[model samples]
Target: MASSIPLRPLASQSELQAFYIGKDINDVPKPAVILDVAIIRRHCAAMLEATRELGVGFRAHVKTHKTPQIAHLQVGDIPNTPANFVISTVLEGETLLPLFQELFRAGRPVNVLYGIPLVPSQVPRLAHLAKQIAAGSISVMIDHPDQIDHLRGFRDIAGFAAGVFLKVDSGYHRAGLPPDGLNKGGLVEKIITMEKEGVIELIGVYSHNSLSYAGSTLEEGMQFLREEILGCREAIRQHTHLLSARQAKGKELVISVGATPQVVSIKGLLQGGALSPSRHELKALLHQEDSDDIGRITVELHAGVYPILDMQQLSTNTHTGPAEDEIAISVVAEVCSVYNNAERSTPEALIAAGSLALGREPCPSYPGWGVVSEWRRPKGPGRLIVQRISQEHAILGWEKGKGGEEGIPLRVGQSVRIFPNHACVTGALYGWYLVVDSSREGEGEGERVVDVWTRPTGW
Candidate 1:
């Protein structure tokens, strides 16, 4: 039976942090979430620097790892840098209030966008959060007029008009109005009317190139980014003639687009000479002004999975680096039983993780739920993958015609780490992360737990 003391994950952060600070990663609970602090820091900082070099704004999404420790790092804590983030849940925004409060006190430029297409019921709570966060801090997404009707404009109620980003479909058909449909139902006129009536300050267009994840090369990812930029531009272009003088000459219209694959490909902008023409073309395309009648077009890049990468992100092949070096989080579980050539044709070991621990999101690169970290780089016996699962059981098996007939390398009680197919949902399974650092030297190459980051649960 499990202990009733409620020691970790369910315990308070202070209690958990005090207990796990100096422990080994293997000492943590089975099938726990693991975060590489150094790797995450490097990934987030590098992304910020790359976007800065490309002259684009960056809005980090907090829907992946909902912990404040990672969220703070993702917000760009350095002085003189504007801090921006988008949240998938109101709880995530509420959970980061202290961080926002700190930034507001320091007078750093800070904004948190509630990144769903607005519905009427969430307005009250969202407006409440807006009232307390910071001036010009809260923004909402709008793709329909009914959403605005229920929002009722935040002017009189919240003491300020809410900032709005018109969601553009970007050919994904996920959400938001398509660029070609801007004039279909007078949506552009509705947006102008909202701004004209002090109902909302049109913050410009927001999009995601999710289709890029299906791509296999960096060039394909870059093409998705270009298409995203063009789609956002087309939306803004459709509305230029209708903007009032103040709205037209007001803030620079910001275009925010990202999917980790697309954002990771932007690092090529700093690569020398190899894609010089592509870089120049992207720069020119990012800033285009047919006439002064329209406001300047600026850009903001947003992504969630780039911080703690996964096998799915690796399949995109956007960033140039070792896969093991970039992928951060993994599921560390112990082998419950070994099923070798007896009942299984190849080799399999029953692990302590199942659908609840390692998510079922599929990756095109491999034919399994997740890959064992031991063989992820193919240095040891062979690749062991989570091929089957129950509620709390996962079969760690090797593919047929593979592993060189050496059999499974795992002992019955030994622990194995798994790189999941989806980092975002996989992380949502645990309440806390067993923090470690793979960037530095230690008794365990990367197996010591340094800190515990607890996250708020549910929406």
Candidate 2:
């Protein structure tokens, strides 16, 4: 460990102690999204391997999991290591600077981009902060031609060319320049022209593959760039004569192609009978400079998985409960009302496990539903009941056993915390988490708790 940052402000040791054990907040009931550190490191290593094989730089975006501890690991050692990072929000950019400073103190250089913000008032501060850190290397994205007006006078005011990357749509209609269109040279021409005029330095051409959009897949993303890169190369070639005409000059241009998903998936597209290089060869290709001609660029895999582990561990017990199953999480709630006295007046009680946070909606997971845990209801006892889930809350109900008793009983003050099917989103919803350890049961490593870490919320 290279000296740990002070944990005081980042998290409270005592609260951390209580969180891991899956304790409730105040006297009211509460739940947590547990994270496993080992699981995150495993995924990070896998992503790094995939990025390296694609002949592009691997600058893990820390916006997904905005934890300093994880960011340090992703950026490497600086001067001795490569410091390439892609941040989404300004807050993420600010938070990352200190981590970079730490690396600088130890003799490392950090290069990072907090994507690009369209608003006008943001440019100056971003530029200033970039200058403050070692290898500050701040870059932003530009999509439309008119947006450049917001940046007008930037050259006169800043005195230095801004590092910028042109945003290519790449089949994802979310935001960026379409791979091809009448607006063909729209944003790209403006950016390159600005660079030629010394307003901003066009470092590279990049794309954002909004997988959630139409025609955006790993293959589509790569193929889209293949054409765009070829197109841009031709555009630049056409400019050769114009260059001589205007006596203009610029260095070789580079294009950066990737989204977190496609970045790792396109590594094997060129493989064949005997014409393909081994994975190791591809990794080497991506890490080298001046090698951009070989379709090389950086891929952004924001550190989403890392946070799932280093933050909190979801609690899952395999033991049987007093109900029909041993490993089920039972919830008891009153029927309140049942339309035609169809049900009892007693508060409903049920075996609650996975809830809406787990991606289960319209209908919640019924019995035999297991996530993070593998438990089942027993064969000999209480009513094995499962019911629907409400937004932000779940309602479980059950009738009495084989006997003549009424429905299961749960008082007004009783409640149970559930383990989420997907822990990542759940983790993002809270500012801090309660932790508990399996080995120590109630004690060990002081109660571990994690603060709600995140990148800048606004652009």
Candidate 3:
């Protein structure tokens, strides 16, 4: 039996202000994670606008900002339509299930996709949780045939069928099944057969092209997307007979693609004419018609890190890079010491944030763990970089020849905001995000703690 978990009390605005308002970045304790709620709202709006323009649905991946407040922003104010959302963990699904249920009860179409693949041992708990909510409200991902059998056995015991989406390998080569080529593995056929046999209801197909993130140019990302769509189409083509059988039963298919880089690239391509052919191909795939000339297929995009822009997002833009001001989250650290190199040729300042706080993810575009934000020094040279990070200390260094005679002229106790390489991992390191109002004016004086949003960490 699972133990009931009590909900944490939300801190009142006045209570939060007593702890955070009027305190300067330097004075609010070191190595703290701060979130600009205003900026987050702007990012959410931009993503929704792009998806709307592209004529596709947006399913915000809550793995980045694992808070209900942020998730509410992603879903928007009107809850009439299903607020399409995805989660990376069962715990996250459990955490957000009640909210989704409440929305569903209020006549809102709410759907939650537990994006991760599952095993037999985990099916009971997931099924039990799913049973508590609206029928078909929760969906799971499956990439292999045996997992389907496992799900079937669990369903027989539990007396309820679960909705599942096929995880296709869209150049990520990680955990999904290959969508293209001959169906020698018979995965698609098996899935369709199982659906017909009432073992599991096939909800859709999902793909995550991670290669898009490492692609050097925007064209590369588009090419990957093209291949992904082609692959999905090929899968459907090979299983045409099976699809026809399923479609006759009034079943529709969904093509879900994600990864922040690809989502942003697709949005850019849809806006610009530079890649007309690719753009047209994507639109056709997204707006595909069936034999009866009905738009039976729907395209859903799932991305997590866009809500909190980081160094990786900026470098991966490949087009008009995001302005530094758009980055909403930052690690505020205080300088504990300053020292010279062994040869005394360069000086380095040690701060409080490190791998434990900012994460150890590599920033290939930047020289260090993270780049120093120009929030405080808008006109000053943005030369400071987190060159190295220990368990609890981040060593800050300036670009070669950019530091003056005394090496950046930094003093102990000085505060610096470090924008992490990956905001998702960095955000996971903290317990609560100190919400700041970016719309406020002046140097941190008007910045008040509007709320204290707690983050759901761990598995």
Top candidate, metric TM-score: 1
Q: How accurate locally, in lDDT, is each candidate?
A: 0.79, 0.44, 0.73
> Candidates sorted by lDDT, descending order?
1, 3, 2
Candidate 3, superposed: residue stretches over 4 Å from native: 1-18, 153-159, 181-186, 269-275, 291-295, 318-323, 340-343, 377-382, 442-446
Clashes of each: 0, 37, 1
Give me the displacement of residue 392 in model 3, in angstroms: 1.0
Q: Which candidate, 1 or 2, would have the higher lDDT against the true structure?
A: 1
Q: How many backbone clashes does candidate 1 have?
A: 0
What TM-score goes with each of the models? Answer: 0.93, 0.60, 0.89
TM-score, candidate number 3 = 0.89
lDDT tens digits, residue span 106-132, model 3: 787767787777666767767766677
Candidate 1 lDDT by residue in tens digits, 1-459: 012213334688899889888877777768788888888999989888888787778898999998778878886767877888899887788778888878878878778888889866667767777778755788888888767765564555677778888899998888998886765467668777777777778787899778998989988888898889988887777667776554445666788998999888887777776666666677666556443645676778899989899989998988556656788898888888886665767667888889999988999887888888863233545566788878788887775436446567667778888889999889988888888888768557667888889886677
Minimum summed lDDT over a 10-residue window in model 2 is located at: 311-320
Model 2 C-alpha lDDT per residue in residues 296-389, reported as the tens digit of each score: 2333333333223211111111111222222111122222322212264533443322353433422122231222221222222343333445
